[model samples]
Target: MKPFLSIITATFNNEKTLEETINSILNQKYTDFEYIIVDGKSTDNTTAIIKKYEPIFKQKNISFKWISEIDTGIYNAWNKGLKIATGNWISFLGSDDVYLDNALDKYVKKIIEEKNADFVYSKVKLINNNKEVIYIVSDTWKWNQFKRYMKIAHVGAFHNRKYFDTYGIFDESYKISGDYELLLRAKSCLKTTFINEFTAEMKDGGVSNKNVFKAFKEVKKAKINTAGISTIVAFFDFYFSLFKYYLSTFVKKLIK
Candidate 1:
């Protein structure tokens, strides 16, 4: 029998934080899940950290599998994991992120309660380099909010296996907004539930946060291709988002 959940991490050169990511999984109160690490053939000590934890996972009777290879992008690595995930639900985490000890346990309970939900997403804490939470992401799921932007937290969000069978895997073409693109494929019909709890701590300086303009560009493309938005409308939204981003950055600098 397969596990109830499959957690995947696509990592590259994360030697400094991969061990903490692994340890977070090891410390999870909920144990009946599989953990997969898809490495982009890191030149650092990431593989050594993975190897060190392999025996511990096996000893604990958890199905832990990993692969180190050259992938085009994060979505490609995630697609590789999706192909072999033997679970009813799947989630992705970054190598620099970590789960709260009760995270999996909370999700399992929510899944049991919401049998009709295809996607379940919870709030995530955004931590600075010093590990202090700056803010929390993801509000309650609203169709209007989703239509405008990616309002749900992608990290640690649970996607039912059947959703993949119906809508297909993450679009490998997307470098940044692949998670949003996948959900946009479902359009307005995606059944979702929001859990009002912080499930994980995501480092503030991820690729998307660092490259705001590029990420917004991909999001606009995703809206046009998958969400049935007109190119003009998408571009307008993109520019508006860009304005907001710059305004916020300016305000932050002034406050500092």
Candidate 2:
């Protein structure tokens, strides 16, 4: 029987957290799923770790395929994974992140019950290197509300394969915020179901987090191209985003 979900993990020299990320998926209560890992020619022990778990994956009947090569960037790796995925629904799991236990089980159940939703989203927990959960991102919003804030993290989103057939894959042009652009496009064409549960635990210090200015520039461009919001609205949104970023930074310092 074909699996209902395809989870793609993109990585490059992520040996430190790769095993934990892989184990999270392998240990899922939901058994029927496909896992694909796209590695960007890492000069690390990531490949060895992946190989070490080959027998375990085989025992579980989990379909696993990994490609190690130099890719253009993260978006390109994600696009590669999407093309090879063979499940009814698709979701991306960064190599440094981990899905909550039984996350896929809950997602599949919701899909069966809803029957008409094309995209599904949920909350997420942010965790640091020590595996200490720092904060929970619990905001859920429809397309209109999403315009105001990007509350849907990529790790917490799952979409039907049909969505890719209609709208196409992630734009490779965006280095830091391609997922954001993809979500906006998906929202414009499909009705999304927001599940009130934590789907995945996201690792801190991702590319977007590390390169703040570049991410901001890409996000602004994405808002202009993917989002149909007017230029004036986009400008205001950009200004508001800058304000929010600074405010959050200040709050974090205060808490520290």
Candidate 3:
């Protein structure tokens, strides 16, 4: 029987936290899934970390495959994962992210119940480098909101493979906002539903957050090209999110 889900991760040199990411997937109580890892030829201990889990995956009867090679970027590595993924639904996870304790159990159940929905999204827990829960990002969003912001956290969103066959893979040119662009493209042709669950824990300071200027630039371009949101609206949303983040931090400091 084919796997019901595939969890794909694109990593460069995330040796420190990659183990937790892999272990979370392997420990899923819901067993009908495959895990794929795409590495970007990390010079660090990333590959060694992967090798360490090889026997564990086999002994546990988990279907797993991974490859480390030079790739253009995260989006390109994800595209490679898509090409080889054979799951009915595929979810993307970063090397520094981990699923909640019952993430797979909930997602698998939701997927089966909401079989017709093309996309599934859930809220996420954001943890800082200090391993503290800084925020929970599950602001309710309508499907029509994709034109403005990335309402769907890619770490907690699952895409039905059929959408990939129809709408296509992540645009490799975008280093930061390709996933958001893909969500925009899917809005036109897919049915979306949300599960009221906290699905994953995203370690803060991701690639997108680190490259703020470039991320916003690509998001603006994606909005204009993919979703047809005006440049003005896109710019507003970008700045609005920035302001919100800083304001929240400032407020936190005041409270402290």
Model 1 weakest 10-residue run by lDDT: 204-213
Tell me the lDDT of candidate 1: 0.89
1 or 3: which has the higher TM-score? 1
Best by TM-score: 1
Q: How well does candidate 2 match the true structure in TM-score terms?
A: 0.92
Q: All candidates' TM-scores?
A: 0.95, 0.92, 0.90
The 10 consecutive residues of candidate 3 with the worst lDDT sum are 204-213
List model 1 lDDT by residue over 1-256, tens digit each: 3238999999999999888888988999888999999999999998998999999999999999999999999999999999888989999999999998899988888898887788998999999899888988968777777877987788888999999999999888888888988988778799998888888989987444557888999999988888888899899999999999889888988999
The full ranking of all candidates by TM-score, starting with the best, is 1, 2, 3
> Candidate 1: which stretches are off by over 4 Å?
1-3, 206-210
lDDT of 1 at 27: 94
Error of 2 at 25 (Å): 0.9
What C-alpha lDDT do the candidate models reach, one value each? 0.89, 0.82, 0.84
Q: lDDT by residue for model 2 over 1-256, one digit each (tens)?
A: 3337899989999999999899999889887888899999999999898888888888999888888999999999999998899988889888888888889988888888766677887889898878788878877656787754567666847888887888888899899888778778865556777778888999778434448767776777777777776778777877787778879888978999
| Clash list (residue pairs), candidate 2 | none
Clash total of candidate 3: 0
